[model samples]
Each structure stands twice: as C-alpha cells, then as structure tokens.
Target: MTTKKIIQDFYKSEAFINVSEMEPYLHPEFILEWQSSKGFSKLDKQGVLDLTKELSASYVRSKIRILSLVQEKNQVAVRYSHFVKTVENPREEMLLAHFFVIWEVKDDKLYRGYQMSQIS
Candidate 1:
C-alpha cells in the first residue's frame, strides 16, 4: 500500500481506541514526539501501545476526521480531529482533540512521528 493509504487506514481503523488493532500499523522501533496542550511527550512503540490501552479503557470508540493529507515519498502529513464515544456515555460522541502530524513510514509501518495537538 502507499504511505498515504496506510496512514489513512490507520486513522480510520479506530486503532486509537483499540490498542490491539494498532500494532500492525506500527514499526517495531516506532517513536512519536508529541506536543499537546498538556505538554510534550516522547513515546516509543510500547509507550504508544500503553497509551492506547488506557484510551481503550476510557473510550468505547473513536473517529478521525481528516482535514488535510499530503504525502511526499514515505512521509505523510495529516491534519485531523479526533472524536470519541466514552465508555460512560457510549451514546454520545464528543470532540476529543485536533492534531497535525507528520509521519515517516518505514517497511510499510509507521516509523517516526512529529505531532502537535490541542484538546477540544
């Protein structure tokens, strides 16, 4: 698959709230450097999985709305918003955050990412 297609699939897969589903899209040595309203964090593949696990416990499902997507070679840049249905109120979907991320795909998996986000 193309790099852009891989990234689009990853976001639309609800992998953010389904930890097990995300593993296939991540490189073994994946790393994410993130800056958010809460602050900055650096996460390795395992760290990302752990965070997704926590998200899975809190959210029943998630949706990613892609505002913009651009690809150049093995890198993709995406601007999107995340919406989630909480475990407490699965009937209601709420905006979770807005993000801009640049991802490097290696071996057809997400290798490195630089991301910025704002809580909604």
Candidate 2:
C-alpha cells in the first residue's frame, strides 16, 4: 500500500477503539509531533503510545478526517481534523490542523518520522 493508504488505514484501525491496536502503525523509534496554542513540541513514538494509553482511560473515541493531501519526494503533508470524545465530558470536539511529516522508509521498514502540526 502507498503511504497515504497506510496512514488512512491507521486512522480506521481498531487502535482508535482500543489503544492496543496501535501496534501496526507504531515503530520502536517512531516520533509524533503536534503544536498547541503555546508552541511546537516533539514526542517519541513511545511518547505517542503513552499519550494514547493514558488518554484511553479518559477519551472513549478518537478520529482523524483528512482535509487535504500533498506529496512530494518521500514526504506527505496532510491537513486534517482531529476529533475526540472525552469520557467524562461526553462532548466531541475537533481541532483542525495540517501536519508535515517526513518519513525515512527503507524497504518495508519505517526507520523514523518527523511530524509537525499547526493550528489551521
């Protein structure tokens, strides 16, 4: 599958329902990044997993809707709306942003990825 397809599948995977299903899209050295109103930051893939694990307790569902897709060379930039439902709050809210992701893919392995998400 193409990178886009793989990424889309990751969104639809059971991981969104149960955090443990995240294995397919996660690599040991994985990295995930996103910006808040404060500033940009970095998270190792483990950090991403940890965040999800913690969130699983409070957030019942998570979903990403692709708004746009742009690809050049080995990079893919995707604009999306990240939707989440808080277990306690029970209200779903969305944060719209675009992510710039650069991946180092060697054969079937994804060695690393750097991602940046900005408010849109």
How many residue pairs collide in each prediction?
Answer: 0, 1
- lDDT tens string, model 1, 31-114? 999999999999999999999999999999899999999999999999999999999999999999999999999999999999
lDDT of 2 by residue, 1-120 (tens): 676666666656657446577755676666655565558767776676677787688767777877776656545566566667777766756553555555544333344666666666
Worst 10 residues of 2 by lDDT: 102-111
- The lDDT leader among the candidates is 1
- Candidate 2 lDDT at 38 equals 57
C-alpha TM-scores of all predictions:
0.98, 0.71
